[model samples]
Target chain A: MTQSGYASERETTEGRVFTVTGGDWDTVTGSVDPLSNEKIVVNMGPQHPSTHGVLRLVLELEGETVQEVRPVVGYLHTGIEKNLEYRNWTQGTTFVTRADYLAPLFNEAGYCLAVEKLLGITDDITERANTIRVLFMELNRISSHLVWLATTGMELGAISMMLYGFREREYILDIFEETTGLRMNHAYFRPGGVAQDIPDSAIKKIRDFLVYLPKKLKEYEDMLSGQVIWQERTQGVAILDVTGCLAMGVTGPVLRSAGLAWDLRKTMPYCGYENYEFDVPTATTADVWGRYQVRLAEIRESLKIVEQALDRLRPGPIFISDKKIAWPAQLAVGLDGMGNSLEHVAKIMGQSMESLIHHFKLVTEGFRVPPGQVYVSIEHPRGELGVHAVSDGGTHPYRVHMRDPSFVNLQAIPAMAEGALLADVIAGGASLDPVMGGCDR
Target chain B: MTIEPNESSTGGVPVSADPVGADVNAPAQVPSSPRKGMFGITGTGDVSGFGGLVRRHPEIVGTAKPYGGYFDEVTDALEEAYPGFADAIEKVVVDRGELTLHIKPERVLEVAQIMRDDEALRFELCSSVSGVDYLNSDARRLHVIYHLTSMTYRRRVRLEAAIPAGGSLPSVTSVYPTADWQERETYDMFGVVFTGHPNLTRVLMPDDWEGFPQRKDYPLGGVPVEYKGAEIPPPDQRRVYQ
Candidate 1:
């Protein structure tokens, strides 16, 4: 459909004149045969901006309504899971953080927690490290939600919100850069603790974000929350009942919107989430609007948590005391914009021979986790991000399986979009927020 | 009192609990011995001595076995719940701290259902379903793993079922409901059939795809091309790409 303000016309030889509407109505109509029993196959992605990231949906259409939607993933699969088996335990964190690009901290935390549990040192993680983890995770949650808002807005035709959302997200990335030395795929959360301590400059930036984001959130609400077009496009579109959501393993805002407060953070506390004070946002409508409202409310809740975490911040050791489990030194950005801290280099070269040897051995071979397996799950921005890591009492993992929420949640598309208008597919898919990198990893 | 040799073998040592005879399997006592270094412990003498120790304490013997990666507290709980659970379980492994119980392929769904419905063993949330191909293992190479969580107890368990290549196993979709996509994914990747699954169509991969890619035996096919006048080999041909 070209947005040219005119309906293209066509004529049939059966003494009837029919208008061929939009671009290539013949191809569209030819793809479907009204007389035949075969369903029309419509390919929706791989290049579509609304499919999140390189996701392809093959929708079986019956006229304007969807009959079935089969999502085609793995176009972004980088074999991160298979590759983890080849690397040492410590090196594995760098790979996992790249799985869920939007919420890298959560991925790292879940992976590291599982490894720590295997090592039987879950209780040994320093309080400072845990608190920093909570702070960064919440920050990651906010940043991820902002991307969701931005992309969802763009998909729903609220173009300006896209720019506004990215502008706000840039501030969060700036904080990440200052602290972890990388914006995306920071790999900041190590097994026993964080890669580096938070800098005062980063803390000030986060405080600034805490003040700046709430006002911007309200501005977004003012702009689109009550707008007629936004309401029409989102409200009552792609309604997913609680049964459908749970059946499809769709958790997070979408499931929360379906009137089920099934957040892993509240249901199963990890990393001292039980100590935090924040409300789990829910909506009863179970529609696109419900998901939108739930996510917006969640942003507010996350902001509150971040503010509390910032206030609770105290100076202490950021890494675990167990030298075997912890990274050798805090990483800093190199001249080439890669991680290369002075402490790391000094330990590698100028330190005592034994110290240098230990550092080299630990870095190269990594510590062996006791032979066991652990499944560590966290409430990611999209949904439940679980890491099923299995160690064979070796330096490397035996099997590292990531239960990426985006991948599982994307299964709800056909259930939600079937029998709905084709236009609703965009709304439904955007509401699911399936990041392809995470899904295909 | 002197203990019977048969009773000792069965780990049925009797202890006084409140003056009543309680059958508590007392940890087998060992004589004070000289410590052995790491390398020394792997010698023939140490191996035989270790084997003798196992012969004495059979209950704690299997606990130290070198499981590939399937390890977790759930395994211990399952063993406690069903005495001789290791016998019932087809395979018990400790991988990375995640315990995997490879149950009989047929009993997978039933075991999963029981795990969910039993109040004491409530695995309320089916967190993830995945598949792995152990081509170098047994003939039944396809392994389906289900990660279950009990929100109430704050514990997690993994249920694994393996099938021979082209064989089918029971589906747990009815038990957890979340196993729908996971089962499909297993089927898609490993060609493991999940009987009685509601929707067992291919997910991620196209419906008409020919081979299961995740299996170790399956060649990693790729598009070969020339990059800057240099020939690029397929994935299966390359050991490590620069």
Candidate 2:
């Protein structure tokens, strides 16, 4: 067999050789001859910077033009959804928030809304709680978009923009830390309402951000929007038209960039979105430039929403009034910076037996959702973040399927890259802004 | 819809308006019934003979059904547009209060395309595509579920198509482009082929992988615990990674 021209054969001490052959390789390689037109298979990354976290793209290229691009995900699949089934409903928020790390609030909000609708208490969310959710979500949107801008900028060779983008994003993270005690995976939004009230320090920080961010946005626009290199690299590259977008089930900024204003926020109005006044930004040009312009405009619109939510933030109860659903004690930071409000523990353990028992039962058993299913869609930074939550009359979810926009949007990559230049593949992929954590989860 | 009165805090501070309802046990109906005829229901399963009780407030009855969860009025509107809708719908299940329609697998793509293009049933957004293996349940074990939303109506609907193991079904990637990755994922994990998927290649797993890992029947492999100072054999003697 080795003499028959299989290059990979190994010879034994007895002078016999065996050829290992299977998996269409003989046909794929095209000939028994070693010097034939051998197709090259290149693994782009489980470590490449362009892959956006442990994503490996196996590209089959015939000299620069890609014949096939196979995305190898699940390198970051943490099994968070499966883990949610074992925990209580309230505790599940902590897990889902980590799925799409860039847009943590969106994950929490989607999970909470699904549970709230299951409990038939969607309408009971207070204006204050709703306002706070809107505030954090938009702020998180800006932060997520900033990460996109930073990474996309770096990928396109605008090194300075990357630094500036992250620098500004750090400010938003600061606000999140002050409010929720952590920058990322802030599981602040509970099933019925938010975990706690926003503090004065966080309010001041957000107010400062609202005033400061617009000027920074202009600076970012001036740096990249008109730069001939940036324009040439992005404009008219990776064109996924409305038909293609809809067919591929792509949503968020990418879909909007294709000229459809299908924003779930404007369309569905979850968390009292209809009451707020903000435009759903869109672009007519279905290209990389269009995606860039749409996301930039979206940051501005999210700022507008954040401003409105802040102004409407009157003092009120942050959690649901129903004791069964609400956390028995309020969460507050201690010296160790973990939640340990002494007053709350004292009330539950020392002062009131009912409080202690309620806390015990709620923490252990969790709340039961009627055996039914509901799909809740919210506008996340990337696009329509829909949670299809099914409960089988149990304390945990029967099936929790997330319509992750990043995952759906990434399908357009092959369509966008097949005929385009190799360099444009980076721009096209970067513009899509896929987070593999979200994609694989 | 009378607003609850505000109460004063212990320190003489006025408590904020309790926008969340105070009563956890508010008299709302809950869906509690398991679906009947696990497979194959004969001709429109219309209990409409229940008349005004179901028609005037269908959601109430829908919510009250055993295993009944919260029922949305939007699905009710869709029921009106597609005549014989109840017959076409195999099961109306509320899982965590999310509405799921277990439609026959052959009609999955057609119904999805209609939901996207139809003026009233504009489920313009196909949010997620996933597959569930119900090996513990019926013989037709694979359920390809689609979560769709209408941006115009601010409504949502679940479209489900079930196929027996080793069955091939029509692909919806042609109708909703986003279905491509999802269908590919389903094929990768469940071994349920999407007949006409342009690039139905392995997504998460390598193309060379032998079995679908997500199927309930697929064995979850584990390694034997090695003893302290145990002799380990080379590659040829060791079992291959699954």
Candidate 3:
């Protein structure tokens, strides 16, 4: 047998290059020490399933320990903000709703608030409309957090947790579907008000939901919170202190998990959040488990707000009074889906000629916004969903920029994953609850 | 007229053109918009279509002293905290109940540092960093905006800096690490260079892409699509209501 381990060994700029034939394969592996493999670099996704979305991670590993981790995003970038430039201000809601696909209502709410502020109609939004906004926003928050729990649970090996979480989320989606025509990307929100008023059937469904959710939540807590595997996988993993989170602009459950109660709803009240009575949940651990606890508590808090908002709901106008700004079509559900009501069609066809003219101009060109820029932010289920809207006093927006929480919170991935085990990278990133649709948009 | 929410039996949601007329007790006057009948094609010899409506650049003017609410407190603290406050700032505009401090592009980093560490004005979290291109309106076409939140005081302030096309500014990632990806996005979209960004590369676009997608001068690229017996032009080519 030959004593030589390799056919050839040389050093290049890439460091070591070795050539081995079948005859020398056994000899080379036998001669090399397993621990002396030096550095290992792995590129783990842009397509991998466990990444939660179209997220890529570059990891420098020493055995199982991750030395450096870099999260590479932008695979899902659809140029949403760029596309918004060509559309009217009201149509911009459709584009932004697709940014954070899960929290579609939050995206619309933030964008609408900014546009309304720019139009100087923030105070004029009807009381009923504000209540409806709060109601739907909280519902959207629960659905989004449920998806987070489902996806993160799936990634962390709690396969049944995914099923249970999504089962509950589907129930909420049904309620949303009953109100808006589509379950997702409704674009229901407008600068002046919602696309349509909520019907009593959807209200009844929401009442049923309010009763059905508490039991399911309790069931989930019993199934996973005390489980040993769940604890081992989540607790004391990915510890980023309050300073790290704040510096990285990490808000939402991640920031609350780190022990600072800096919820925008509580700290900087908007959309009548000050009127709602609820507590901001916090866990001092600042780890994956802390995030999990915080999210669960938040779901309960949201349920409280939802119940309150529902009770406060009264019969009144759901849109602003201004015909020039309000949506021309009074939407109604037909066999085909939500569309212009027959009554509206009759009025324009038969009644006052001025109403018809106003409808044409409003629907076609949209109302012009006063030329200026304003920034309005609301607390998204993920974090702060901020809209920076600029207008040149034209129907179309000059430029609209969204500061999506997923995009900002993802910056903390490296700070959490650098010194942890390679598996912990998945756990830490899931804790931040990043939605790539929002991050890349 | 006000209390009949059960007027429509279909799903119990009243679906009537009645929304405008249903609320009898409340005073919501749906103003009759200025009537622009047909023949109201603007920018022509026609005398209709609200021709009196003039489009002018919304001027940028500084707010006078005692800028109301917390804005005054913020300006005073920044003045006391930073020694070069006046030299570094271009203007302080308070509009729509939001305070905007327009700092010189060259002095953004220094201003940001003072903004973060100032005990009285401790803006610990940077909510966002974004770019807006004011093309054909301002000489410095690219404008960068930063939203800072003082968690302690529950206050928010916006910092803006203007730079020319293809211009450079210091990165604020050192003070607020969250700006790393956001700065990259601004650069990728608007071509505003952050000189000291650790890894300044195309974030939302391919590295070899030719033009910035969000710039005002860049064309909205699209391909023509053919339908049943007709062709629809791209969005950029379509005639829109100006």
Tens digits of lDDT, candidate 1, A287-372 = 99999999999989988888888888788887878888777655776655446578767766785788777776677667877755
Candidates 2 and 3 compared: the better one by TM-score is: 3
What are the per-residue Cα lDDT tens digits for candidate 2 across A21-104?
Answer: 754585866667553344577888889888788877777766667677766676776556655654568888998999899998
State the DockQ, from 0 to 1, for candidate 1: 0.22
**Residue runs of model 3 more than 4 Å from their true location after superposition:** A1-33, B1-54, B223-233
**Full ranking by DockQ:** 3, 2, 1
**Alpha-carbon TM-score of each model against the true structure:** 0.78, 0.77, 0.88
Candidate 3 residues A190-229, lDDT tens each? 8998888888999999999999999999998998999999
> Residue A242 CA error for candidate 3 (Å)?
0.6
Q: Better model by lDDT, 1 or 3?
A: 3
Which candidate leads the pack in lDDT?
3
Model 1 stretches with alpha carbons more than 4 Å out: A1-39, B1-102, B116-124, B132-142, B150-155, B164-166, B174-177, B197-202, B205-242
Among incorrect, acceptable, medium and high, the docking class of model 3 is medium
lDDT of 3 by residue, B1-242 (tens): 11112222111112332222111321111111332323224357755545555456767998888899999899999999999999998899999999999999999999899889999899998999999977667878789999999999988899999988767899999999889989989888777888788988878776655445676655453311124644333364565664
**lDDT scores for all predictions?**
0.75, 0.74, 0.84
Model 1 per-residue lDDT tens digits across residues B113-134: 7677666677777889887655
